[model samples]
Target: MFDEKNIWDTFRYGDESSFKLIFEQFYTPLFNYGHKFTVDDHIIEDALQDLFVKLWKNKDSIRETSSVKNYLYKAFRRVLLRKLSYAPQVVGFSSPEDKLDFNFQLGHDHTLISQERLQQIRQSLSDALKKMTPRQREIIHLRYYEEMEYEEIADIMQLSVSSTYKLLYRAIETLRNNLSNTDFLLLLSLLSLKKV
Candidate 1:
């Protein structure tokens, strides 16, 4: 049987094997999460490298956590944000927050749903997602796609628990207003936190 806490403890104690396990498990998820912030794959890779490097260097001093994935996500996000903050300024981009432009698509599975209707829903979902602010998009992605809890999201996003809830509410409301009722219902089923 696999034991995540044991692995985390060993990694914190400077075991290379445990660190490899932790790295392999979280790298892809961390990469995908970082992609939501910027389109530059190189920057994402560099930030991920920096994150892992820092973690490895500081392992002996790191505290064991109840949720390893949450801790990694929170740490990686901060590293990625700091990397992003140094980019060239764009028009209307007054700060690092303004640089965030989150966009995502809905992937359909189930052969039962017709391709044409699926395409329509995907378009509608994409359109609705585009209407939300980057913060709203991040909250929704964490809450739905990543299946994160409000507290986890609040910690990662540096917001209060109620703030994460409010952000999700606004995001869902935007989707509800933009998508047809049928598509909205379909969305609920489509976003059921698929096991990865």
Candidate 2:
């Protein structure tokens, strides 16, 4: 029932209600998308808040978006990249086990899965993601988790559209190979059944 165009128009016309609506709709998804990049919750929170504040301040200059979701995601990705550039070196992976541990802790879902299964699935995905280069993981996160267009991702990562596609293709192949070695079929079955 939420009309994105109407909401944008209202926001452009200085309507607080429309801006509030947009924030409410996108807050969680954007947070989750940001989490896929960094383990720091405070950093993610600050980034999202700053991104929305900027959106409101620059409302008049905002272009017509084919998808509001994509617009928000692109903005979030840019903010995250800027934040990462300045963050401490400790933010980078220190070890494979450390990365896996952090990722498992970050993506663990208590409501969606039993603690044991959550740990197992989280470890599996974490290990797979850790095997990927930082750039590849960033691209995959932007494309799949954030749902940005390839062109937008290319602009964000400073790569050509074809290069972005190739990066994603290779990342997917790597993920498939890594995940395939685990109890991936069982995990998928559990995920599909909502019993994970």
Best by lDDT: 1
lDDT of each: 0.79, 0.77
TM-score of each: 0.79, 0.70
Task: Summing lDDT over every window of 10 consecutive residues in candidate 1, give the lowest-scoring window.
Answer: 90-99
Q: Model 1, 70-177: lDDT tens per residue? A: 999999888888877776452111224434443445455757878767777667777776677767777878988899989999999999999888889999999888
lDDT of 2 by residue, 29-141 (tens): 88877666677778888898899899989988988777787678778888877887778653633223353333334554478768877766676777777788767777877
Question: Which portions of model 1 show Cα errors greater than 4 Å?
Answer: 89-113, 180-196
